[model samples]
Target: MQRDYNLIDSNRQQQQSKRGEFLASAAAAIAAAAVAAAATAAVAAAAVAAAAAVAVAQQQQQQQQQQQQHQQQQHQQQQQQQHQQQQHQQQQQQQQQQQQQQQQQQQHQQQQQQHQQQQHQQQQQQQHQQQQQAAAAAATAATAAATPATAAAAAAATAAATAAAAAAAAPVNKASI
Candidate 1:
């Protein structure tokens, strides 16, 4: 009986030792799984942070592009305004030059008209003087050739012919006889 009790006690001690070894292996597996989960969470957080940084960089680039476009548009508008102003000024200057030329042309035409009038008046006065001298010579010739009563009639007839000749030869004027 003592031998059997000793064998049973030895078997019970071996089983308890096997159960303690299995429990220790299970605790190590749980600890390893918790470490893996922690590492995965850290990786996910890092990925989210990187994505946020990339988004911010893209937004900044878009804003810079927009600003540059706005500045270029403003510059173009200002240049167009300056160009329009220059064209307007050139047109005004051309108009002024044309007006001045027209005025000068009018003055030149007036001067030419005045010169022609002066020449015409001088020619008329010379013709009048020549007619007067010819009439006086005819009257003297008639007085030498005729008796006193006939000489007066001849002088009167010669004067009438001279007036008719002058009227036919000269241009009509406001002051002409």
Candidate 2:
């Protein structure tokens, strides 16, 4: 009976040791699983952060591109406005030049008219002087004819009449008369 009791106790101890080993292994497995879960969560969080960073970078790039496009559009608009202003200034300059040319032409025409009027007045004055000279010559010829009875006087009268007839037949140039 003592030997059977001792064997029974020894078997109980062995069984208890196996149970303890199994519990220890189970706790180790649970700890390993917990560690794996934590690692997986960390990896997931890192991925989320990286994805957020990439999205932010892409948004920033898009905004920068939009701003650059806006700046380019503004530059193009300013260039067009400058070109239009240059064209307007050129047109104004052309108009002023044309007006100046027209004014010069009008002044030249007025000067020509003044010169022609001066020439006409000179011609009229010459014609009046020629008529007075012709009348004086006619009066002198009449007075000599009334007292002329001698042959020499008669010949002088004939020559005077011939000269007067020749003068009437000649074309009068008022400027040279």
Candidate 3:
């Protein structure tokens, strides 16, 4: 009877010990589940924050792009204006050069006309001198003819002097031309 009583007490203690271990395991499982739930909540909050930051950054980048585009357009407009001004200046310079060339041409033509007039005057003077020389020679021949003794000699001398004058005048006219 004593041994049966001891066995019964031992079995009761073993059952109590198993029940304590199971309760401890159940508490640990509950604690683990709570921690997992908190972790999942924190992860979701962080994801939301990151998404907000990305959206703000994208909006700022778009605004910067717009500003840059506006500035580029203004710069291009300025460049176009400068190009037009340069072209206008170039055109004006070309016009000035053309005017200078025309003036030079006109001056050259006037100089040529003046030179021609001077040449004509020279030719007229040379012709007048030749006519005077011829008239003087004729007068000398007439005087010699009245003397009768040297008439032939005077005529020959007058003819030689006239021929010499014509030859000299021919060379002078050719050199002028």
Which has the greatest lDDT? 3
Clashes of 1: 0
- Cα lDDT of model 2 by residue, 47-109, tens digit: 999999999999999999999999999999999999999999999999999999999999999
Model 1 segments more than 4 A misplaced: 1-25, 140-151, 154-171, 175-177
Candidates sorted by lDDT, best first: 3, 1, 2
The TM-score of predicted model 2 comes to 0.77
Worst 10 residues of 3 by lDDT: 139-148
User: For model 2, what is the alpha-carbon lDDT of residue 140?
Assistant: 67
Give TM per candidate: 0.68, 0.77, 0.52
Candidate 3 residue-pair clash tally: 0
- lDDT for every model? 0.85, 0.83, 0.86
Off by over 4 Å in 2: 148-177
Comparing 2 and 3 by TM-score, which wins?
Answer: 2
